[model samples]
Target: MKSFSILLAATAASVLPVSAAVAAPAKNIVLVHGAYADGSGWRGVYDILVKDGYHVSIVSQPLTSLTDDIAATQRVLDKQTGPVVLVGHSYGGQIITDAGADPKVKALVYVAALQPDVGESVIGLAKTMELPNGDVEESADGFLSLASDKFVADFAADVPKDLAEFMKASQMPVAAIAFSEKTKVASWRSKPSYGIVATKDLALNANLERWMYKRAGAKITEIDASHVVFISQPRAVADVIEEAARAVK
Candidate 1:
């Protein structure tokens, strides 16, 4: 009688509905940083996500060209063992918009980042609306960077002064042509997307961010911070990313 009971339990388990076995939530996160900043700026977001049991990786893209940055992002995506919630900040959004098309990417999160549609370039979009701060500097060799004197005011008004200075000192200069290079694809169309708009941003127009996120149909979160929203409001930024991660499955 005991043997027969065991056999009946095994049969019932085999016939259980497939819905009982839900797929695991994505645990990997890949972060991409925009021009003028390195992956280190994602440190705050990284620490928060890690503490919550996520496997996070940050891509340090060379600001030489959009194509090169996309390739750098892809290399990091390739190393992720499972599905990823890809996140990008500032110009890094442009990189992820292209690289997020990778099959490994399950969701996208843009933090005060640019999201250009096909046939659009960063320069083209930025030109659509005037930037609040006019302290951008272009080198004779065709590289672009924020003026050190205005970096804090224009890019990180909410960030502590000393850290902002350090960020300015270590800023990465981008190839001027990168802003003019047109986007080849808009990955958000195929993936679930979330966006954080830094309402007080001076580097990139806040209204432009709204327009782009609206066009992409991303779930948008507005934070009252400077251009470096992730740095200033890491908890809020991480919450949006976690929401995307949980909903992707």
Candidate 2:
């Protein structure tokens, strides 16, 4: 009778749903926001991923120091048990490029984001190409911001007027010193990557976005949107991330 009971218990455990067996190690999606923004920028993307049954988290970068931001991201990466898909937008791209080196990160997705090479600072990368709208401003505090006037036309052109206005009003100040700091490591060099190019992006310039994508050897996806592609096209962003998550080894 005892042998029969043990065999029955083993059979039942083997028949459990994959997701229930050992919890199946949920795949993690870490959303990293760019300059003049916080993790809140990923709210829409986060909501969608949640509905789709994904384990997601957003990294609220201080925008104060590159090392601090990378460390913050790494801290989150360290907590994840399974594979991670690191997604970054705009300057957030720089953060992921360095932080994604964590062994837990299986793939990278750059959404209208910068992908700097080794020894390249944000300024150095920007200088290499001509941007459509020159709207970046350097403040006396040694930080960078977008000129309020250009916020609508350059940063959030595709978004509704009201939301664009809100984004302009709530823009975070990014430390200028952060732009000069070089990424000691760039994960895209070795990891598989996907790049989304905002065709109408005025902040970074569409051409420059494409150039970065090609330079990084990323599988490219183009969207008719502004620099904040994730905000204007959350579904598309989520779809690409979903694809990357499933493809992770």
**Per-prediction RMSD in angstroms?**
2.4, 3.1
Candidate 1 collision pairs? 34-92
Write the residue-wise lDDT of candidate 2 on 1-249 in tens digits. 999999999888877855463344337899999998778778889999999999998888789888888988888888888788999999889999999898889899999999988898888988888878778898887888899998888888887899889989999989988889998888999999999999988888678878988988999999988888899889999999998887775
Write candidate 1's Cα lDDT for 158-187 as tens digits: 999889999999999999988888899899
How many residue pairs clash per model? 1, 1
Worst 10 residues of 2 by lDDT: 17-26
Candidate 2, superposed: residue stretches over 4 Å from native: 1-26
Name the lDDT value of residue 163 in candidate 2: 86
Mind sharing the TM-score for model 1?
0.93
